[model samples]
Target: MPRPGARDPQAPVATADVSTAAESMPRGQRSAARPIPALTLVSHPTAARIGERLLLQGLLAGREVALSRNAPDFTRPGEPLGLPLGDPFLSRKPVLFVPVGEGVRVVPGDEGRCTCAGEPLHGGREFGPEELARGVPLEFSGRTVLLLHLAPPPEAHAPASLGMVGQSAALHGLRRHIERVADVDVPVLIRGETGAGKELVAQALHARSRRGGPFISVNLGAIPKELAAAELFGSVRGAFTGAQRDREGFFRAAQGGTLFLDEVGEASPEVQVMLLRVLETGEMYPVGASRPVATDVRLVAATDADLEAQIADGRFRAPLLHRLAGYELRIPPLRERREDIGPLFLHFARQELEALGEAHLLTPSDPYAPPWVPAALAVRLLLYPWPGNIRQLRNVAKQLVIGSRGQSFLELDARLAQELRLPQTAPHRTPPPGAPTPAPAPEPEAAARRKSTEVGEEELLAALRAHDWDVKKAAHHLGIARSSIYDLIERSPSIRLAGDLSVEELTLCFHACGGNLDEMVRRLEVSKRALNRRVKELGLVPKDA
Candidate 1:
């Protein structure tokens, strides 16, 4: 019997025959079932040592048997035995043993057609007798049995490239947003802090897009001012000095695919105007060319800088910003989504360690344990401004994994702390105790107490409102854990539940923000995750009422 998961040999052969076979066989014979060839079990030294067993059934009674070192030559029996010989015969199966030889072969008939296919007595193929005598070992299985090799099934190939790794809510939301926009031909503007993996997101969008052309990525800030326009829109020969030949720019190169413009806020006004015209009409005029060339391309622009702020400051064009930002996605900085740092650190460390071929030296525990960044490091990471975001974190992890000879948390933390110029400890300043202590008056004492209470109440109310009166959002917005937020809400008297909000107020805020969560989050200065959780917890249905 064939092994489990093994493909049936007849299936492929039958498919090929059905597709390619000609009409030569008689109709009755073609439809009639042929007797399956007898299966002879062959054992090798390895198989025998492992005690592998094979069971066979359905045999004709009184069939004559002959055994040989190579192929078995069978002859018809002169007399039938009591062991029945009909098609429906049932009886104890007889066990027959043939002499052990270099290999086993079964000859089914006198016509030289062997069950072994005349190929070999074992797993290997047999050549002519002369070649077999020359000690080629008969190209058979010999004393060692081996399994047959089979082809793999066809499948749609997934890209083998690496992508940003992290399943934190922030990253999941970003992935969902990318999926929603990838197939559309609309322009996408990605805004994030530097090192926040904006380029990776752009690449993912390109990979998911239907367009099959080249994905051209251009860093607008990297291009020289004189060559910016020509580089983006292409240039004709003799367009400028030393112009040897006509060159197709990124826009033309990326036809039908995606054109990624990184640091787009850095584009000069002249380039912006040119880009605006190209976006307005799907045509571009090459430098020194009289006519405009029409080209199809999807635009994906990324900027660490705030383009809206740039426009307000007149550093960027407002109209161009609108054209570029057809669909805007903002990637949160690492500091904002500190929950993802642990996974990202491990991902980069493993990648770098593998690249250096020192993967064995670095274990999975290396990134999570002390001497590098301990569990306490999460708090520090949360506090960090992370001006460089995920990119900086990846670089730091790579550096630590490469530089640290001993995978200890303390050593790693010391190195990181020193590099980041963290304070060793809080500084202490002693004041003169002899100096007269300022005594608070009754009115001033009362005012100070009232101010303290007001600050606490304001923060509590702000968190409560941001979370839609759900305790969770209030906690996240305050940067404390969920339990802390719940405790504060339980203690606070001024805060109201989301369900208690007047229908009119809910409708007003929802309409004012156009049902945009990010806008709402920003308006409330609350964490998006917390706000969403609060929305669900509070059972507040969004007002289209």
Candidate 2:
């Protein structure tokens, strides 16, 4: 029997090369050459050492390789090579890698559920140039594995605020993008989900640029609409009712440097037009000033909003977007780059300890050693989804460092469970010998129900109504986990608070938002899909109609 996650004994285990592998395919199919080969192992929970060696030897080229726990049968047609993988969830044959034309196709074997690049492939998926270039991850039996692709190593980049943290290809790719464009003075639009560090990218650009002036950062969304122009372009004495003296605008402050405008999507149409003029003319007129002042500044704008959708809704100016997006850089979300979480957490923890003047508590000999965080804790950290991305990770690090108080792993886990609302995992450190074994406490909601005898659906609905349908608030009120509230909602759709969000209210919000889905999402706190579904269900007329 093959050990768990075993490599093929006969398959040549070498690092997969796209160009070399493509040469083996027929000439007509050579156009499908991928930048990265599929199924490159970066790290494995159990099989890294053996798997890495097996890969170094060689992988099957120009042939189908079936992966399962069963031995290959020589009698089968084509005599397909079989590599056994020891996974409880895998079927006798779970996945098959077939050489198709110029690329390899990944098909499911007669086994457990399999995912290619996070997407379920019921009928299997043939690798396309785009799909192979991205080097999507594969998942089997809750185990994730990175695919190998042969490409040039990314050029080095060292951001001033956030040094290179992970060895993952995605992070490396992001660094390459920054390295290529940092010195360029053209407007760059940095787009990503919130907490993905758009501001850090702006800082990196400024640090890498040739300009010497100070970097001026502004949050456009935070600026009031009425005062946006004056705030961004400066104002002369008596420019407005409260104008006391001449003040330099962000552009003037960033002269010969970078001006990072975050949340640029929040700028009004008038502001967008003003920005376009500034970009075109390299000059701005101060509030109540007749003369245009020439200024030298490189603009870097960032937003989580979808500019294309905003443009379609007539809320964002197309010309401004075109000018701003001279070079677009999208930072991947934390969930997509799980490899970075551990290192980032350590980095944040160090910073937190240093801030608290507890730097000495870390290993006295080696400053880089993780004094508080253990390997098990690190694994747990990596497993988390981190919906809030780096920002949430930093907050968690802060809580752990403070809450742990140089205590045991049990204390640390408890702190994490309380702050992040995570389930407790096995403790890294064992309890003291001869110590009394503590019994597991019941869930907060269970305890509450036991005490008050008010655990019915009516009470749950009442709590949800009291909290405006926020599951977190309702869970807190009922002393239960938020997941329990979600379960309640899922089990009984009719339990939703009446008049909480009526069809008329949704229609008004839709119109009030000018049909901008993102704005509506923010205002109503509903997902885009939910909002769209509700609109269709209500038969609301389109804004265009």
Candidate 2 local lDDT, 41-135, one digit each (tens): 32223221111211211223465666653533211111235233343445665466766554556677743366543356667766644444434
Q: Write the per-residue lDDT of candidate 1 for residues 174-215, one digit (tens) a residue.
A: 665676667766677887757778889889888898347788
Sequence-dependent TM-score of model 1? 0.49
Worst ten in a row by lDDT for model 2: 48-57
Give residue 534's lDDT in candidate 2 (0 to 100). Answer: 71
What C-alpha lDDT do the candidate models reach, one value each?
A: 0.50, 0.58
Global fold similarity of model 2 (TM-score): 0.53
Query: In angstroms, what RMSD does candidate 1 have relative to the true structure?
Result: 27.2
- Model 1 regions more than 4 Å off: 1-162, 361-379, 406-410, 413-415, 421-545
Residue pairs with clashing backbones, model 1 = 119-126, 122-141, 123-141, 370-409, 371-408, 371-409, 371-410, 371-412, 372-409
